[model samples]
Target: MDDNKNLFKQIQALYRGLFAFVVAFALIGVGLIAYMNNPQLFTSDITASETEYVPIPEDDSDKIEDGVHVRTGFVEADGLMETVNNCTNCHSSELVLQNRMSKENWIATIRWMQETQNLWDLGGNEEIIVAYLVKNYPVIKKGRRGALTDIEWYDL
Candidate 1:
């Protein structure tokens, strides 16, 4: 009975401590919010903090317009006009952008599209489109990171 009482008292003490810690964290969060809203209330006589106020940049120059997104870079190439003429009639530029293939692979893909997706024959324009795809969208060797070593496996 005495041992059980002691264990219960320990658990009660632990819960009280946890509750106190949570209340302290909440109060600190509320205080920080209030201070941010009205700095004058919290800065009566305290020295300046080490943190400096760095204003966020307010410029649109950072926004780059790839031809795919902004119609600027897409139609600039010689053979790309043929690609756009035939390609966009069926699917989006996003589909083309996602794929990276060689000239032979591009031709194979076109043949597959004709066979399955009911794409029309490009005739002489197929060569132009293939050249453009090979030149612009060759296979990008994305060296992905391998699985993480020394992982600390845990159970819930």
Candidate 2:
């Protein structure tokens, strides 16, 4: 009879512990539901007068040139955003601005990047990007300075 009573007490303690655990879990669940239903209840409110405000002076250096994007310096034209998004991800916009090339060269460069640099396939955006680059930054005829016209020979 004593052994039986001890076993019953042990079972009662286990049931009580389980009930407490379930109650704790249910309370947490209810708290989460309440929070999910109305989270603004937990957020603090502040009046504008409590915070300090400062004004920033506007600088126009980047925006001086018309049709030039202030941020990337990309010419404002069709396909501008596409080129900026696709090309500027891996490298800076300055790189694109500097390397002026024809459409064929741009295609070749893109292919090279894909083969070596793990650049993703651009699909239709390739044409747009190449067009934007070729339009805005096409190759300039750069070579040795014009033939010397009035150069005098120096004595050895």
Candidate 3:
């Protein structure tokens, strides 16, 4: 009984000691924070490197909060609400945004997802989603800039 009491007493002493140390460190941290002027911290000009400065080009993409660009769940469009309600269940909105397809292609892609990727039949919502996707993300004409013209080659 006496031995058990002694062990508990020792444990209690150790716990008290640890508590005091933790409290001391916390108090010191608080004191340091209280002693400092917050304005100086923000106003100080500090830079690790000043070799090169290249500004990012502005994009029309919407930012949730100005000054910081955070990717949003959905882009602003006519059928945005319908698209969000139907899509974004299996994949991210970013994925949808990245892909561009025609109306027919979008329909085919949705069918493929339903058949293989375990996507449920979107039913009436499918048309709305397809319209939204086609309107926002149309197939780009990816080819040469101008019409082809036959040019005569002369030996150098």
Candidate 4:
């Protein structure tokens, strides 16, 4: 009975070792498959020459009426990039888009920001940014929706 008990204990230990080996083998196989799929994950060496640089076009004519920019969603115009760099630094472009104020109002808003919101002086770039805002997004009179036309009313 003592010999049988010792044999059972040895068998259990062997099974546990085999299980652990199988699990380790599976993990290694999974890692190998992942590496095979995308070897770039394992590669740490990246050369500077491999990096890509996109040049900004000198011509503004194509972009003037080319519609809104994909990333910023700012209307395409002469000073689109300038406006993006300056305005979007502080707040979201949506804040600019939603309020279609005139040049004077825009300046007032800028002044208010400067006084209260810790906005820095824009200097000469202010002209470009303001021009972009005024020309592209002038004050729109959206008083009310068209008089609730074509609606069927039920009697209470």
Candidate 5:
């Protein structure tokens, strides 16, 4: 009878240890889950602000290359020149210079900007802008053996 009581006590003690281990493991798991779900709440001293960088305009005169006529800019055509001036009034000239688009695409983008983004009507300047973008910013083709072969694909 005494041995039976000792055996029962051992079993009870084992069960209690197992229960405590299980409770500790569950608490650790809950802690991990909470940390993952709310990382900012667990962390100390951090904040963020949304910001955008705008490019500064470059002087057109400085961009004139050698052998180019003084009267004409990179886009010497009167129509294109007029478009560049009109478009760059709101945005930087660099934005206009960096983007390459087909004539149709450029017209559609301009129209969208005007209709939705409060961009003013081009007022006869659309033709000049379209021509300039088409001429200078033609769709680039890949896999050509030219001076650009050494340049990185992303850079082009």
Candidate 6:
């Protein structure tokens, strides 16, 4: 009876140690992921080289029908453009420009970032981003030329 009781206690102790170790490991893993996904905490050390290309502003006065300003250069629309504050903190504007998505998808992506990736809120800027994405990144439609004409093929 004594040996059985001792064996049971040893088994319980082993399980307790294992449980503690697992909990500690899980906590550390969560911490590491949170740190890595937190854009506010992460930063890039890369610098642009002299050979790197920079986009030059274009003159829009000639393009516009009226005296009103039109978007002819990148900087002209920069104010109205939606920027993911957290995303651009470590990434470049080109990165944002290259990626495009619908308004719904953008909202979902932002939510995912907020829930799991530790992305910060944009406050009033959220509307600006959503509007910009909807206006500029609308879904693509099929071209008229792609559809086959009735006279193009004869019935076999």
Backbone Cα, N, C clashes tallied per candidate: 1, 0, 0, 0, 0, 0
Candidate 6 TM-score to native: 0.38
- Score each candidate by Cα lDDT: 0.79, 0.86, 0.76, 0.85, 0.71, 0.64
Which predicted model would earn the best TM-score? 2
lDDT of 3: 0.76
- Model 6: residue 62 alpha-carbon error in angstroms: 22
Per residue, candidate 3 scores C-alpha lDDT tens digits across 1-156 of 999999999999999999999999999888678658453553444662444677888784545354322454555667766776667777887777788999999999899988999988787788888887897788997886887679887999
Q: Rank the candidates by lDDT, best first.
A: 2, 4, 1, 3, 5, 6
Pairs with steric clashes in candidate 5: none
Stretches of candidate 6 off by over 4 Å are 1-75, 78-86, 143-156
Q: What is the lDDT of residue 22 in candidate 6?
A: 100
Which one wins by lDDT: 3 or 6? 3
Q: How well is each residue in 86-124 modelled by candidate 5, as lDDT tens digits? A: 776677666766778887889888988899878887777
Question: Residue 5 CA error for candidate 2 (Å)?
Answer: 99
TM-score rank, highest first?
A: 2, 4, 3, 1, 5, 6
True-structure lDDT of candidate 1? 0.79
Off by over 4 Å in 1: 1-69, 72-75, 142-156
Q: Please give the lDDT score at residue 150 for candidate 4.
A: 78
Give a tens-digit lDDT track for model 6, residues 57-103.
Answer: 87643353353224322232333434534445545656556656788
True-structure Cα RMSD, model 2: 21.4
Question: What's the CA error at residue 54 for candidate 3, in Å?
Answer: 45
Better of 1 and 5 by TM-score: 1
Q: lDDT score of model 4?
A: 0.85
Model 3: colliding residue pairs: none
